[model samples]
Target chain A: MLTIHTKLISAMITQSLKDHPIETCGIIAGLAGSNLPLRLIPMRNVAQSENFFMFDPQQQLQVWKEMSARHEEPVVIYHSHTGSEAYPSRSDVELAAEPQAHYVIIPTCSPHKEEIRSFRIVDQMVIEERVQIVRQYQPELEFQMMVA
Target chain B: MSITVIIPTILRPLTHQQKHIDMEGSRVSEIIDHMDQQYPGIKEKLVANGNAHRFINIYVNDNDIRFQDGLATSLRDGDVLTILPAVAGG
Candidate 1:
């Protein structure tokens, strides 16, 4: 099980909203052990839908390549529902092809309020998992993680 | 009582393009075995040996089977089993 910093996740969602108001999604890749350390890897947007996302295969491969270069595997995938609950729609569940990765959704249903949720997409099931975002700053950083 | 198993698009090849299949079993494992018998080689897409594919996620009703008994998860009459893919989009 991986644990993500809630504050970092919040920042990602907030930035995603601004970057792709229509709908935004990305990947989080990191080491699988200790602190469950992770790095958010933004993916191509799954063009807007009535209440779902349509993922892009080409982008997926690109992200996969990037992770491979860094020896990091995709651990979670995140998207935003501009005006719906942070839950997987029937379509979302049907299209989840990577069972090992987590599906995270950021719901912008309520104006001025943003909500983030994470789930595990198993064959025929969507499992909600626990996520934590920390609030701290470590300047003079040697490693730079992308949040766009 | 038998339940209907909904096969996702990615898995339709295993079911000959049938979206829904009916089977009878008290546990998920039994249902999988039943499917294997009905459709030769179907088990390869679902379970490997006595375990399930790491990417396949099973759900009873709307809850994830992982939180339940996994392959041993129980089923009741009229329950719905959905087999979905692990999609990676936005």
Candidate 2:
């Protein structure tokens, strides 16, 4: 399962819509090995193709350096599908490099309605997972609420 | 000069599951050619028609080779080379 902040989801959807016809791609970085996504980094689709997207190489390099300096990893690698369903395409499966990162897909074909989904693609296999959106991640509050 | 080449997970199988490999080359293309010699079938995945594949992104010491000299990008002895696919969908 994947747990993400609502604000991040909102930002992703907004960006996806704003870049309609061309897919938007970005990474949500978090503490290394923490598995907690906290940062929403919108990236440029250098390909700028309606059928595909590719991050600007220079920008990607810079972001990667920043993430390394901050001791972070891409907890959530996300992109939008403007013409297809929220499923990993053949190329997506072939290019999935992060086995530990959650692959989030926001389908904006209709623009009126959205179906967001997350998957784990490792070695050409795609496994859909549940997503829990929270306004805030409060591990301490969870225990207190459980006891209350 | 010897450089460290970090292989991405997708290409790990072709690399005998090796994550990192040390090879000798001064230019990015030379290193890629050497890698292909060591692990057959890898060059095709990384290069196509004498150019880095459209989906492949190679970086040297945190800087993308595309912004530099691409396949002709020069390397130093302790430089770290990373190969990753372009993250995209839709």
Candidate 3:
């Protein structure tokens, strides 16, 4: 399962809507080896095509360097489907290099009630996963809720 | 200089499923050519018509070769080279 903050989802949705008809792609970085996404990085879609998206090579390199310096890895690799459902295409599954990453897709076909989904793609296999959206991370609050 | 070439998942079949290969080369082109020698037909996937494939992105130690010197990008000992394919976003 993939757990992410509500604020991050909002930001991603906003970006996706702003680039409707064109795909918006980015990575959420997290502490290396932790698998917890905490950083939202919006990247340029150089392809600028309604059917495909490619991160600007220069920007990708810069962000990757920064992540390396901070000892972070791309925990969540996200992209938006402007007119399709929140699912990985055949090409998406074929190009999934980071097997450990949570592949998140947000569908922007309709402005109302967008559906966000996550998946794990490894060795050309796609496995849809559950997404847990949290307002905030509070150990005590979580414990209290569990008890109640 | 010894360089580490990171093979993307899509091209791993050509490299016998190896994710990375250590080779010796001082330039990006030379390393690619050497890789072709080791894994025949691999270069065609990364390059086409005397240039890096449009869908392929090559980076050296987190810096894009296109922004630097393309195929002629200079390399040093222990440099990490990453090759990845451009994928659909929408």
Candidate 4:
């Protein structure tokens, strides 16, 4: 299951809508071995196609190096589906090389409705998972409730 | 010449879970061949049709080999070679 902050989801949704009709992709990085995604980093879709998305080779290398230096990993790899439903396409499964990442898809096909779905595409198998959007992470639950 | 290769998570199994490997080569193709000698199946994962697979990016010292001579891209000692699978889809 993907347990993420609402702010990150909002950012992803906004990016998806902003780049609608052209599939946009990015990754949310976090400390290595920590499932908690902390920072959202958007990648330019070099393909710039409504049906396809690819990261610029130079940018990808740079970002990956930075992540390694920071001792982080891409916890969530996200993209948008402009022409179809929010699910892994044939190409999506073929291109899923990061088995440890949460493949999140934002569907902007409908103008009035917005949806976000997460999946685990490993070894060409797409397994949908539940998303738990929280206002804040753990360790402050009682304090958060009192403040709320 | 010794080239340091930073392997990604997916390819770590082939490297015996070694995050980074040092091998001897003067060019990108030679390095790949040397790696294959040690790790039998990793070459096919990185190369296809005599070229670096389109789905993977091979960067030598922050510059992608594709912008150079591809598999024939020259390399020097102490250069950092990083291989990352492309995060792309339709």
Best by DockQ: 4
Model 4 pairs whose backbones collide? none
Task: Write candidate 1's Cα lDDT for B1-90 as tens digits.
Answer: 698887755567678989789999999988888998987787787786677665565677776676788899999999988665434333
Error of 1 at B38 (Å): 20
Candidates ranked, most accurate by DockQ first: 4, 2, 3, 1
DockQ of each: 0.12, 0.52, 0.43, 0.91
Model with the higher DockQ, candidate 2 or 3: 2
Ranking by lDDT: 4, 2, 3, 1
Please write out the lDDT profile of model 3 over residues A65-121, one tens digit for every residue.
687688887888899888788889877886677787999998889653369999999
Name the runs in model 1 displaced over 4 angstroms. A19-21, A32-37, A136-144, B1-90
What TM-scores do the predictions have?
0.55, 0.81, 0.77, 0.94
Clashes of 1: 20
Residues B14-66, candidate 2, lDDT per residue (tens digit)?
99999789999999999999999999999999998998897788999888787
**Comparing 1 and 2 by lDDT, which wins?**
2
After aligning candidate 3 to the native by TM-score, how far in Å is the CA of B61 from where it should be? Answer: 6.2
Q: Model 1: C-alpha RMSD to truth?
A: 13.7
Q: Using TM-score, give the best candidate's number.
A: 4
Instruction: Evaluate candidate 3 and give its CAPRI docking class based on DockQ.
Output: acceptable
lDDT of each: 0.67, 0.84, 0.82, 0.89
TM-score of chain A of each: 0.77, 0.90, 0.89, 0.90
Error of 2 at B34 (Å): 3.7
For model 2, state the Cα shift of residue A94 in Å: 2.9
lDDT by residue (A1-148, candidate 2, tens digit) is 9988777788889888898888888998888888878777888998797777778877877787688788887889998888888888887787787888999988888743468999998877899999999877777533322100
Candidate 2 chain A — worst ten consecutive residues by lDDT sum?
Answer: A139-148
